[model samples]
Target: VKRFVHISVTNPDIDSPFAYFKGKAIMEQTLIGSGLSYAIIRPTLIFGKEDILINNIAWILKRFPVYAVFGDGEYRVQPVYAGDLAKLAVELSKTSENIICDAVGPETYTFRRLVTLIKNRVGSSAKIVNTNPKMAFLISKILNLLVRDVVVTREEIYGLMADTIVSNEKPRCSTSFSNWLEKNADLLGTNYVSELNRHFKKINEDAGYRISG
Candidate 1:
């Protein structure tokens, strides 16, 4: 709350890379206790052309031509554009309001549908196959133990699947996913895939191509 324009995700009570919920809860606690003027924004799965994580996932899925859909891919989400969120943040900083608003795209889509949208935008020949939570959990456990990467743990998956569509109580500018995609289709296509490959190469090198016993 200190200065204002305090935007954060709706974190869980527990700690996890899925810690977004917990983290946001703490932030809200701080804001409430701080007694400073503030505006809070909780955005759901913000995406953009140069997004490092979410967009990277989309790009990677496009390149592989095959994707694993965890938990029926029926989870619904409202993806927000990074630019729109950024604008809201700026507005919050300049305006005076002690309110929390959910910043999200106009459309609500299922996880499977999201993949389809990406495929359409990128023109990727990828096939998204339904996957089980057990498999995802196994992969998550391995990654966490081997690489200390908790980005794909069960808790994180829960957030993606079970979390409610962020509320826009305060009301702000809204941007549809289609419009965002139309504006950045090229970036979502081959360009992103190429960049992702280079990124993967660097990651592979940093992790040491192969770990020896």
Candidate 2:
């Protein structure tokens, strides 16, 4: 490709303790080395219609008594709406400069605040509790088993433990998470939607492609 638009995470560090962050760093490095005129769009948590993170958060809030926040739950998360992320990617595709842009949203919420937001939106009485990282991982596993869906992943738990996902750069997306949730409140968490199910469904539905995995 003559030009590349890579969607990555905000400030991924290769040396970070979390594999998710390290993996994003590796992808960005690989893209930079490919000699393509590239613009990397790093977005924080993304919320939108039928989304994974936000919807799943609602699922847990609606069903559970207590929602676990990893560590002290002070990490700041900046969510960019999916439509905004796509709009940024499209705009970057026409550019030839090698640059990195963060497609964050207008609002920044702490990890605990994010969970609380979902809890409030879902009209749930679940209490937000702080759990140690190791304990959080184990609890996530147990929840996944009980729900028969991925309530949370260890990678996600580790990533959320990051200090902050905010960006000083001007946000590419202007949609507010709070407003979006308010608009889509009724449909956020109707049922279990597996990420793998979403992934393979698209692959299997392709016109001339098949994914065995």
Candidate 3:
């Protein structure tokens, strides 16, 4: 291949306790050492039609009377549009230089502010409550059981609290999340998306049928 483009998370660290971040870091290192012209596109939160985070946040807010904010919720996030990230990856693949860059959006928002914006746009009356991360995590576990899906992970909370997703580099994508949300607010969170069902359960079911055959 002339060039390889890899999608990775922002501020990934091999030493990170979180599997998601650690795994990304490991893959990035492996690719970099492979002696290929590579471009590593590190994105923060990516929002689009098939997104989990923003959609789920809207889902929770629309259904629940109260929403919890873990810790002070001041940590910042820079969300890039999925389309924009994809375009950047395609653009980088044509280049021969080994490059590493952040693919963040045009706007940044604090965690609390982001939730509140979603709340307003979705026209939800849920009360935003600030709670300790421990309590929030416990609640997430309970919700996970109720929904039969992973609501939130402890590591995700830790990453959000650390503000690891935001970058000091200039925004590389032009799509504004807030603007996109304005147009898509009515459709978001109308249905819940299940990670297990979308990924693992299907694989398991396919494997079972293959074994039976």
Give the count of colliding residue pairs in each prediction: 7, 0, 0
Candidate 1 C-alpha lDDT tens digits along 114-156: 8778777867777888878788777556644543334365765
lDDT of 3 at 170: 96
Kindly report which residue stretches of model 3 are placed more than 4 angstroms away from their true locations once superposed: 209-213
Each candidate: what lDDT?
A: 0.68, 0.83, 0.92
Q: Using TM-score, rank the candidates from best to worst.
A: 3, 2, 1
- Give the runs in model 2 whose Cα sits over 4 Å from its true position: 200-213
Best by lDDT: 3
TM-scores for all candidates: the values are 0.74, 0.88, 0.94
Per lDDT, what order, best first? Answer: 3, 2, 1
- Ten residues in sequence with the least summed lDDT for candidate 1: 189-198
Residue-level lDDT for 26 in candidate 1: 82
